[model samples]
Target chain A: MPREITGFSNPLIKRVRSLRDKKHRRREGLFLAEGLRILAEAEEAGFLPEMLFYARESAEHPIVRRLVRATEAAGGDVIETIPDILHKLSGKENPQTVIGVYPERIVPLSALDRSSADIWIVAQSLRDPGNLGTILRTGDAVGAGGLILIDDCVDPFSVEAVRASMGALFTQTIATARWDEFVSWLRAGPGQLIGTSLNTDQDYQMPTYQRPCFLLVGNESQGLPTTYEKDCDILVKIPMLGKADSLNAAVATAVMAYELLNQRRAR
Target chain B: MPREITGFSNPLIKRVRSLRDKKHRRREGLFLAEGLRILAEAEEAGFLPEMLFYARESAEHPIVRRLVRATEAAGGDVIETIPDILHKLSGKENPQTVIGVYPERIVPLSALDRSSADIWIVAQSLRDPGNLGTILRTGDAVGAGGLILIDDCVDPFSVEAVRASMGALFTQTIATARWDEFVSWLRAGPGQLIGTSLNTDQDYQMPTYQRPCFLLVGNESQGLPTTYEKDCDILVKIPMLGKADSLNAAVATAVMAYELLNQRRAR
Candidate 1:
């Protein structure tokens, strides 16, 4: 039988709610992954949660039941809770069937196997967690090797980002480092560093994306700064046929990523 | 000299704030287009605002000044207001320099010129204004003919959607109709109807998008219903390489739209 959590004051409940904040998430080295789908993806990625919680209504769900059983089999505790408790934890009016507290797994820059993966995405100072999450989903869709965060990008494990990722968070390897450090790492790596700029007349589709290529995109409003733009091996521009100045950062990244994949796949 | 309005209680101020709601937007037959970039795009597309408001700080901006001058020359009121009023109008802490009240222009299905354009997009009951907005932007990016919103969908003129569109709202021709009505129109049209479905094993890339193509996509959760799926000329699937079951609605639309464009462009 799984343990039942009745009160919001429960130490475990406090911990789960605290995971909403970046400070607590980083300090605890754990993040909340909500919904049965996300938890299932995590499990499939061999990333079972440290703790699992499910509502009574959700506990009756077959996937939730299986998740509970699997969690138990994996030496993890499953906590049955009221819907209100879950609603509070998730900050959603209608919370998901299940939520998991998973350990943070950060892949270091040095450990990245650059030679094995064809394309890598490097984002600089990305502000929106939703954009970051969508980028992760796009990256996974295009079979990109991994993602690297330069400078102060949004937290990938945030609820908004994780939800946006649609379980791509579990599949894609994510690394974070300072701008200078990433520049050094890129210099040492075996890949052409490609960047996007509106000033460049060269069309994005014109390029032949060589293997182990690093496609770097800039922040949303300001775009690629001069500091980062100077380090890129090639700069390409997406043609703007309409009056809209630029595509959304995530959308631009997806367009470029898929184009690169399409080129490689066709060859 | 542009009239300066100081009070938040001003009738114009109330009118501007009320534009945030769809009810007001529809009743007034007008919508809010904030930011200099969006306003510029609106002007460039020959969709001048009926009224324009600019903050003192933003008034000094060269583009804002140009917009103000152009609005005045076009026999439109160019009102100078405090930053707080502009912020309230935009619902942003740091509002853009200018906000414009533009008359709503809804293109009817009958008015659509399908013969002149090769690609079109049809979205069925899309709920997320953000996703719909992004799709509109993407559709514009790929040089699609226009967008058709089927059945009950979020208001494309809503601030959330308009902002996400990044001025593409001014460029793309948006049409709305009941699903049944859309089907009748589709049967009468010249385009091939294409859809994405998980049940379909055919890769999306395999198809040569026929001219005057109607690329149909389902809603966020409940994709195209069986009824609608049966109507599609081609049902294709974007491969999920990882655990993510589906891509974001806007991202999916973009990928498909761009792929179709790429195919045509290559030929």
Candidate 2:
């Protein structure tokens, strides 16, 4: 039988709630994922949460039981709590019945195998957690190897980002590196650095993406600096048919990624 | 000099702040848009805010000056206010320099010119304001005719949707209709309804999109219903290379929209 915690002041509950903060998440090297679907996805990806908390009301759910069994089998804690505690832990008005605290998986740049996949997503100075998460989903859909964050970007372990990822956080490998280091790594690898830029007259579709394509997107407001664009093997531009000047960063990345995927399929 | 309003209790201030609520906005048939950039985009698209409020500090900004002059020329009210009033109206910790109250523009289904563009975006039961706004931006980028909201969707006039649109709301035409009405409208026109679905074996890129294509996406949680998919001229699926089951709605829409755009460009 799993332990039941009725008190809001439980130490484990407090620690799990603290994971919502970046500083605490970083120090503990753990993050929170909510909802049964997301937790199931994480489990499917071979990740067993260190701590799994489910509402007592949901204790009888088949999926919840499976999760509880798997978690306990892995020497993880399984706790049954009331809705109030679940809500407090989730920080949501209508919180999910289940929430999990999982270890953060950050792959080093050196561990990334360039030849493992045909495409990789790279973002520089990305500020929005939602955009970052959406990009992860896109990367997974397009069969990209992973995401590489260049420079100061939002923490992928942040709750907002993890939630937005919709379980792609587990599906896609995430690595962080500075611009200089990323450039050096790319130079040493067999890859094509393709960037989306407004300065280029080259249409995005006009370029045939080479294998091991690295699709680089810039910051939301400034876009790629001129120097950064100059470093790209080829800079392509998505056409703007209407008065709006640009597509959202994540949207643009998906469009470009699909284009690359389609080109490969056509060949 | 523009009218100076110092008091937060001012009737105009209260009215403007109330526009944030859907009930109040619907009753007034007015919506609020913030930031100089978004407001300028509105102005360039031939929309002049009925009431323009700017912090006294931004009066010297050239774009703000242009906007002030344009509002005055259009016989719209121009008020100079403090940051506190701006903050209250926008509900942001740090608000934009200006806020605009404009009459809501809803293009009826009958008014859309299908032949005006090669592609059109259609969504059924979309609930997220951010997704709605991002779809509008995608539609504009691809040079689609407009966005047609089917069934009961979130109000496009909401501040969250408008902000997420990043000014594309002014560039793209938005229409709302029930599913029956939308089906009737498309059937009467020279349009091919292409839907994204997991039920179809046809890859999204396999089909050559016909001109005046109506790309239909379904609700975020429940994709296009089986009956809805059956109604589509053709159903297509984006290939998922990774373990994730699906892509974000906005991301999927963008990927599909760009594919249609690219097919046209290729032709």
Candidate 3:
């Protein structure tokens, strides 16, 4: 049986509210969800929620109740709170119906198909939660082999990341692994590695997707570190036509991903 | 001649902070800025500032003092404030030591080069500020004719939007007009009007970009409303290979714009 906690002072509610802080999220190994869609996505993806709370109005909705029951059945803790409590936890308006706290799911590189990939994405050190989420969603949309997140990236499971992903947080299998180990394994492969840089003479289209390839994009402000650029088998760039020397990290990633997919499809 | 206002209750200060509220932004026909780069872009793009505030730290810097003097001499209200007061008005971390309130800039369609365009982007009611901003930036980079924001779109001039635009907010001449007026102009146009939709049989590649065209993308969640679909000369879609039926509004807009640009370049 699950116990109901009513007050804002309750430790669990306090924990959920504090999930906004990076320290709390790290300590609890849990993250926040603002509305029903994210909770529903987590549930559908078979992610086990640690806890889910419904605003009083949401408690009456059949979908909300059903999801709560499912969460409990799956060994998740469920709670109902006054709207104010929910608001306190969310610190945002119209949190829809339900909020959830879930354990982060980390995938292993063994989980990704290596041989079948015509293209793959390697994300290195992004800071924004929303940017990470959008990148995951884009990688999923383009049918890339899989995503590899290098260290110092935003915690992929953060609330802002999840909300920006719009349920893609559940659908994409992004895993965290040692950057050195992944690169070492990648060195052994017949696959080619492509990285973006300003000085590269290689246009992205040169010697591209006829074989499995990896596309590496770096952080927004400071780009691919010099250490990794030398390791790339192919360093190329999307030809720039405008004075703006940059594209948002996710936009650049998407453009390259789409081009790789299109080139492979044509072959 | 400039005056420094110290009171929190001052109407001007309150109005500036009210910019944090969306309704006030709409009612006042004004938006806020927090940094030097944005201020410079605004000036370069010919936006006249209504008021300016500078901090003591920034006032000592040559560029800051120059801007302060210029803004005052331009017949704009200038207030010199302590760093603490300037920070409050910007609502941003690491305040840029300067803030400006500027009226919205809108261009007339008569000013657009109708003959030079084979591609136009119609943003149909996108409500997210970042996504809308990215759309404008991408539209300009990919060489789309220009951006079209329909009813229900968020204030593209919002601080978050302007920042994400990466200075495209200044270079891109965006015209805000009635969607119906846009549609009637498209109907009389020398180009094909393409709207992005999920159910459309018209694949994005169906028409080559050998001719002038318009691509309309819908809002973040509920895509193009049905009435607007009727307005599209041709509705085309970026093929989604994944289960998620969509991409972020900005990403989708970029992909579509790039496709047009890519097609034209190929020809």
Candidate 4:
């Protein structure tokens, strides 16, 4: 049986709400994910919420019932709360019926097997949580092994990013490291570092991407620094036939990712 | 010389600030755009703002001087204001040094020249302004003729959409029409309607996209209704090789748009 919490000032509710903040999430080693579908995706990805909260009306839902069973089986706490508490936890006008608090799953850079997939995505100094999430989704779509974040990228565990990811965060391997650390890791492995640059004359589609190809994208505004570009094995540019000088960071990543996937498939 | 205004309560100041709201923008037939770079892009695209606002600090900027000259020459209002006014107008902590209120540009579906470009983007019931803006940027990057919005969608002239467009709003032609009206217009022209759908077995890259291809993407949430999907000339699905079932609406559009572009280029 799930615990019933009617009080607005419940301690558990307050604790769950604090997961919205990055500091609190990092300190607790847990992050919040909402919506029945997302929570279901997490379960499908072999994850069980440490704590699950659902509105009273959703207790009869088949997926909710299954989630409650699985969470209980995993010795996790399940709580039934009111719509007000759901709204408070999600910080949205229309909150999801269910919310989950899951452990942060950041894979170490050294642990990633480059041979697990033919393609990988690397983002340096990516600032937008939404873009990060979108990239994760695109990475998953293209069957990339994982996403490697270099330098100060936005927290992948943020509510905005988690929501924007549409559950791709649970699907893709995520690793964070300094630029030097990432460079050393790449040098130790058999992978081609393909950087998207404006300075390059080579078109994006011109190259035959090698197996274990690492597609490197730059920051939202500044793009990749010259030093980082110099480290790349291949530099390519997407043609901008219109007056706009560049595509959105996430959009550029998707275009490049699909190109890599197409090239490998054609081969 | 530009008119100088310091009072926060000045009528013109209040009026420009009100342009941030959709209701005011629609009523006045003007929309707000900010940043020197975006305004420069706008100028390069042959648009003169009806009213241009610049901080006194930016008076010496070469681009700002050129803009002032062009605005004055075109009989547009040019105002020299403080940072506070710019901040208020842009609704950003560190606002752009310049802001412009330009006339809204929404071309009718009948007015679009189908022969102008080999590819066009069509979106149905897209709700997010950021996604809408990103799609505009993608359309511009691929040299697509324009973006055709179907049914009720977010206001293209909203400040959020304009900012997210990153000045692509000035380069790409924007049109809005209801589903029936759009179908009529499309039938009257030479174009292929390719839709991204999960219901199809056809791969997105398998088909040779016909010239003047119209890549249609649906809503962020519900996707295209069954009726809309049935209306498409070619329905294809992007392979989701991972756990995530779909891509972000804008990401899907970009993926599909580039595929169309690539197919055309190969021919």
Please report the candidate that would top DockQ against the real structure.
4
**Comparing 1 and 4 by DockQ, which wins?**
4
**Whole-model Cα lDDT per candidate?**
0.87, 0.91, 0.76, 0.92
Kindly report which residue pairs in candidate 2 clash with one another.
Answer: none
Candidate 2: tens digits of C-alpha lDDT, residues A135-243: 9988988899999998888898887788888898998999998888889999996899999988889998887889999999999888988888888999999998878
The CAPRI quality class of candidate 2 comes to high
| Candidate 1 lDDT, B143-244, residue by residue in tens | 887899997788999999998998888888989888788878878857799999997999889988899899998998888898889988999998766566
lDDT (Cα, tens digit) per residue for candidate 1, span A1-267: 799998989998998999999999999999988998788888787788878999887677888888888888888878999989998889988888798888887788998888867889999999989899999988888788889998889899899999888788888899988888888887885789999998789888898888889999899989999978888889998876666668889988988888788788789
The segments of candidate 3 whose C-alpha lies over 4 angstroms from its true place after superposition are A1-5, A59-66, A107-113, A177-181, B1-15, B22-28, B46-81, B108-111
Candidate 1: pairs in clash: none
Task: List the candidate numbers ranked by DockQ, top first.
Answer: 4, 2, 1, 3
Residue-pair clashes, model 1: 0
Ranking by lDDT: 4, 2, 1, 3
| Clash count, predicted structure 2 | 0
Q: Cα miss at A76, model 4 (Å)?
A: 1.5
Q: Write the per-residue lDDT of candidate 3 for residues B1-267, one digit (tens) a residue.
A: 668887778898888888877789889888787677667766766665789888866677776777777788789998887776776886666676778888767676666676776667777777888887787778667766677776877888888898788767776767766787887666665878777887677777667754677778887889988887887667787776654678888888777778887777777
Better of 1 and 4 by TM-score: 4
* Preferred candidate (TM-score higher): 2 or 3: 2
DockQ scores for all the models shown?
0.64, 0.85, 0.51, 0.87
Ranking by TM-score: 2, 4, 1, 3
True contacts kept of each: 0.65, 0.91, 0.39, 0.95
